[model samples]
Target: MNGGPRLFSILRQGPYLIASIHTALDDSQLVRFQQDLVERIGSDRARGVVIDVAALDVLDSFASRTLRDIGEMARLRGAVTVIVGIQPDVAFAMVELGMDTGRVVTALDLEEGLAELDTYAAAPPAPRR
Candidate 1:
């Protein structure tokens, strides 16, 4: 692990899961991390994911798109994705850029985000076909 606050941390809170991203999430890194997350959730039986983004100083188009894609991908795998610690300025920038963040659940801080994950996990699962 890189000593610089770690790029990400995968934590399991009962049936809920969190991927606390502690650095700027670029495209290549996001892809690899998402794959790792999928695998982790597969083994851990987690129902939701909280992506912590407090340490990121910037959110560009590529990063924003990657986040959206990750969220969608996680959802396809039956895991809800929440974006946490989005700075106000960064959030504004994303909105200004026309990035549709509506699909992403947002939280002001990591703890709040994790709490949301707990709620999602506790909720009833969707009915299967």
Candidate 2:
């Protein structure tokens, strides 16, 4: 169980699920969030997931890695994860600290995040070679 306030909130939006994280997540909260996220993705059959981290005051190395890990785990369960709402300072800090969320797409805000998912959904399947 998370010792602090809930680390994240998951909301279902059409075929996509939006997970918005609260500020200042410790290691335990991150683990719990991942487990709960996996359960939600499977139960909801989410085609895409948007992680809104706009609320966080800062994005440290641990949180950055955890977000990427969560995205990868969701991907394994058949969801394309997009991380959105990274503050300007956080982005600068992430670069300075050498932190990267590998392979996780991102957007400027929630609206753009939803649009990204919708665009992907609207695309026709690639024709077989």
The top-ranked prediction according to lDDT is 2
For candidate 1, the TM-score is 0.82
lDDT by residue (1-129, candidate 1, tens digit) is 465556788888777677877777667777777788888777887778888888887888777777788788778778888888888888888888887555878889878877887787778887888
Estimate candidate 1's alpha-carbon lDDT, on a 0 to 1 scale: 0.79
Candidate 1 off by > 4 Å: 1-5, 126-129
* Predicted structure 2: clash tally: 0
For each candidate, the alpha-carbon lDDT, in order, equals 0.79, 0.87
Tens-place lDDT digits, model 2, residues 5-124: 666799999899999897767888887878888789999999999999999879888888988998899878878889999999999989998998899899999999999888877887
lDDT for position 112 in model 2: 96
Candidate 2 residue 126 C-alpha distance from true site, Å: 6.5
